[model samples]
Target: MSFASLLPAAVLFALSFRLAGAISAQTFAPPSKGPLVQTANYTSFSNNTLHNKHVVKGKVFDRIIQVWFENTDFATAISTPAFEQLTKQGLLLTNYNAVTHPSQPNYVSAIGGDFFGLQDDAMFHIPSNISTVVDLLEEKHISWATYQENMPENGYYGISYKAANYGNSSAKPYSYYVRKHNPLMVYDAVSQDPARLRNIRTFNDFANDVVNGTLPQWVFVTPNMVNDGHDTTIDYAASFLEYWLVPLLTDKRVNGDRTLILVTFDENETWEIQNNVFALALGGAVAKHLHGTTDDTLYTHYSSLSTVQANWCLGSLGRQDTNATVSNVFSFVAQKTGYKNVHVPANQAPQFNLSDVAPGPLNSDAYIPFAAPNLKARGAGGGPVFLRPGLNKTLTVEKLPPPVDLYSLKKAVPWQMSPRTTSGKNIIPCADSDCK
Candidate 1:
């Protein structure tokens, strides 16, 4: 059916308001039960009745949105191909930063709009007042889902990645923050409801669900750790994106018209104060070469969550995301129709310093760096080194001889190097962990 044909009486009512600049002082009837969701109304603004009638575009209904996550954890190798392609297609947040250290707190900050200072993956009970983006969406009747890559029972997290109780190891677990996202499991109201629970699905199930016509308004797709570039090589991560993310970008129902896909990292390998591992916002209403132009805003994960919350007019998530502080990443609105597909840059692994690679510097910050519970022992600036907590050491990294683990570099000498500074203020702490 045509959109015009599906326009509800509310359009006419809204048109009246638009015409007068104020709603009529009358008994406005409640919305009727209708299947079609309304986006806007056409109101005449010009005096010419024939062709000159001004068509005043008003509001659009809740838009269908998706946040496709890549292994943005800065500590690990990043997905370069995906980054180039996505940035050209949409908005690249050159200044995006994760609020807390480690994966769980960043995820929590992204969803909940504030991290309650969580620093580890020890599985503490989710707080009742910990309002999430999902919670706000639910209050407004907007639907959302998290589609994991290889999570077996939808939200499964093995005690170890090799736990037999959870069955064989899968490819999706690494991509999704299983430890942090587990709060969705604790929300009794959502967990008990089959409709909400069923929304949590696997990536393979997405196409059928779309064909079966069950796509939600918002989707969070996380690939496994290996594919997300967390534990595996960058080349493997690029292949995963080529196979999984690219297909979804090309889907008719998921892309074009008025859809958005946000790709971001949880945090960097180093628990330092930086904004390098930024996010890319692609699909619908984004501008290109937003790629190299970094937005030097002091934003964290809460900012991203706040942006989503504001887009839906869902309000704030506490002191962290008050009306004034939310990140304005989703500022662009779609002006044209049809698909403006993203073009991936031919060059791969765009050379970058530690800051360009991840969101922040390594453990320079006492909070996330030394304070974070997972700090490995400081190793020599050489290959596959370990950092014992409190070991003060510096490893001079040569540009490309042996590909040492980036995480080790971030951990060992977190102090700024080339433009290195002696000031200790640049250090960032790992969330929920002890700091000196």
Candidate 2:
């Protein structure tokens, strides 16, 4: 059979559409005509050293709230009133897709730019040195927080809710909250820091924060499994969004003129959907003219980090996020900020190995750190190292992964995205059972 004959017609059609819509970074955004806003101790997030001002600035956010739904396909999602209603009020990304499956890595990619070899929802932890957008955000003095429904307590890092599971001791109790769905839990930078850890509060606390006016500048919210359509149906998830999230849209503080709330699913339900998922940009931050408009820009989890970095002028990690495409909604700000947004090459942003779990030392790198330049550097397996920034000098280190010659100043290749097992079942130990 010919190479063309090998692909199913549906998949071939989908790939063709994606290729046809390959747009440039500035297609939606024209050149930024606005003057640079000068603030004390601030710099532009743009990577162009020439464009570098003092700090991460621009028409960024006083607040950005993102709510992630689970496992619903695009066609089914858009048909729902809750999602459709959002499109009417905001920009719709008609060609958005998730990077991978079983959830965790997509969440990781959203913040870190690269999946770092994570392929399953297992309670996998990334080394602190691996770095997350949090590093960039905090470097610019930006604040962030995550809220999880049915989370046991503030900064609690357990697995599931026995209370919500109806005491069904059958391993893998069905509950609203799961750590795999909460991305920050795996990061030692946030989870290990007592100060940052406290910010990982429960969903109930999210409402409290909103009422108390303590909402952070960046808020990531995750609904329980039922609400996110993990164990429940898409219709239920839509209802959950309508009942819970719709109210937030009316809040001036949340959907206020400066606030941008991204509503998207983690990935599609099965392996055959090609990862297409419904995505919406709704909030006060979106321009009025852009509302009700559907932009067919192809985007993935990496785009979220791209948008954040672009909005704030935070430099890229030189990873896939540096290469990922930007969404259409950001054109308004990009047109104003003159931020350089680059398009990721096709099939380059770590495609999924879906058929099997990947092997060891997944990614090797050419650029090892001479010294940490405000970027976290990990010893082996992501242990944090305290290196003086701006010194550009060699220093003593902590634990280093075996076989890596740090002395040569060889770039530490963090474990890239792990391929998944054939089963792709997220098995966790629950007493004597494999709860999944």
CA lDDT, every prediction? Answer: 0.42, 0.59
Candidate with the greatest TM-score versus the true structure: 2
Displacement of the residue 67 alpha carbon in candidate 1, Å: 4.6
lDDT of 1 by residue, 1-436 (tens): 2222333566445433433552322221111111111111101111111111121121222344444343343322222445555445655565556554555555655654444434443343333333456656665566677765445544343321221211123322222234344435533344555666666555444544455455666667665554555554445555565655666666755665455666676665444334346466666434444533434443445555545554554544443444233343243421221112122232421222222122212222221221211123111111122122332333211221232333345543232222222112333353322111
lDDT comparing candidate 2 with the true structure: 0.59
- Look at candidate 2 and tell me the lDDT of residue 16: 54
Candidate 2 RMSD computed on C-alpha atoms after optimal superposition onto the true structure: 13.4
Candidate whose lDDT is highest: 2
Model 1 reaches what TM-score against the true structure?
A: 0.55
When summed lDDT is taken over every stretch of 10 residues in candidate 2, the lowest stretch is 26-35
TM-score of every model versus the real structure: 0.55, 0.70
At residue 371, candidate 2 shows an lDDT of 23
Residue-level lDDT of model 2, residues 275-387, one tens digit each, is 77888888877887888887655677777766776676565554556543432225555566554444545555344425224222222222222222223421111223222
Model 1, C-alpha of 26: deviation from truth (Å) = 67
